[model samples]
Target: MMNDVDPQILARYAPRPGRHALLPSLTPQQQVALLCRVLHREGYNDHIAGHITLRQEDGTYLANPWELTWAEVKGSDILRLDAQGKIIEGEWNITPAINLHIDVHSARHDVSVVIHNHSEWGSVWSAVGRVPPIYDQTSALVDTDPVCYDEYRGTVEDSELGRAAADALGEHKWALLANHGVLVVANGIRQAHLRAITLEWRCRMAWRVNLLGGGVPLPAAVAQATGQRTDASGFPFLWEAMARDEIRRDPSVLE
Candidate 1:
């Protein structure tokens, strides 16, 4: 239920393509670093697990190296790898689970960022093999139903299993890998991070609601309208605010 004035104001304040002349271009490594920092701050890290990958124009990608926990990752610690998961740069080895991102990026030309995490509530929902119900407006951020990969084929180190998970993801922006965790794909690192955070929040909300007999879902039309309204501008503002906060906390992430 945003007023007309709100949309205009949001658009006015939204990050423009070349507005920040003093700030350097957001590089791939910085994208990975920002994603990892924000995700770690939000408690998305499961020890040294979890990863964020950003596709490069050359079909390669920059990813968080396996050696560093999300919280410990700096821009310089991010690794560059070809589409086949071969390390092209950086000192640390890539995560075996990176195969999942490779297959997903190969299959989905539109997606530029992929995030995988064993986040607490997200994994809980995955274990039950259920998508978060449309309980809150934040649930509308997902827009479509999250697909579930029912088969858990161990660690997803193999490319074939990764392809299967990508097939399960298909056109959806989010996928719940049953008994494993969640994966979120988006056109940019910021959006992917936002989706991952929002999806986890929705899962937590659904869990709490289920404990209280579960609330009814919003009508499809209403949900769709709300999604359209928010998708246009809400996420960009949220992403900017998060990036600002993360920069304030640790400016070294840019290095």
Candidate 2:
């Protein structure tokens, strides 16, 4: 991918230390709005059904309020909710699925962001509990073995069901909610949003491969090595590119 680029030019783009220190400086509202724009750009917007939650330093979280479409989301539209899912600050009520997000966040301290979306290809792939393989470098950004939550207890209105889903997710960064859609969790909103969009793209690729007679899986050793390398350093660049593009397309999201 870096073909023909000068070594000096490539060096300028290399990952630098202290790059992630800026993440914590972002307010919860800014993080939520930026992620919402990223998801919307990736076509993950299922009207107002999808939600992204960013953990706050004060043990609360910021999530998109109900009735606001992803494309319409701005920093002002984000709702601050306590750990119990009660809206502490916002004009609109929380989505019923807030319980699900709350459970996952409570269970996984390592997870600073949770993204749940009924995205098109993600939903189609989840119908059969299929987790996409490491088909390419981009696909390898996700876990080689993503979790598949085979039990769909209607809506995740009950906290118990939410915990069950979190149990199904275990320690994986990606989860295919069987008969529903996909959920991606990560240490930051950028990574979570990047993984969600990557999952959907991987599923689309896998579906096409199945139609044209199944293809051979990458060798286990190669898959594992590629996954490790990509997972370590690929996502930030992808996230930055997408975020910049989204901001250029619609600068109002930052407002």
Best by lDDT: 1
- Once all C-alphas are superposed, what RMSD does model 2 give against the true structure? 5.3
List lDDT for all candidates, in order.
0.79, 0.76
Per-residue lDDT of model 2, residues 128-241, tens digit only: 887766556566555467789999988676667877887899888888899988888887755676577778878887888888987876666876786665554444356666
TM-score of 2: 0.86
Best by TM-score: 1
Please report how far candidate 1 places residue 172 from its true position, in Å.
1.2
How many angstroms is residue 219 displaced in model 2 relative to the true structure, after the best TM-score fit? Answer: 2.1
User: Whole-model lDDT, candidate 2?
Assistant: 0.76
- Give the per-residue lDDT of model 1 (tens digit) for 144-247: 77898889878777778877888899998888999998988987765676678878878888899999997898888877787676543445457656767787
**TM-score of each prediction:** 0.88, 0.86
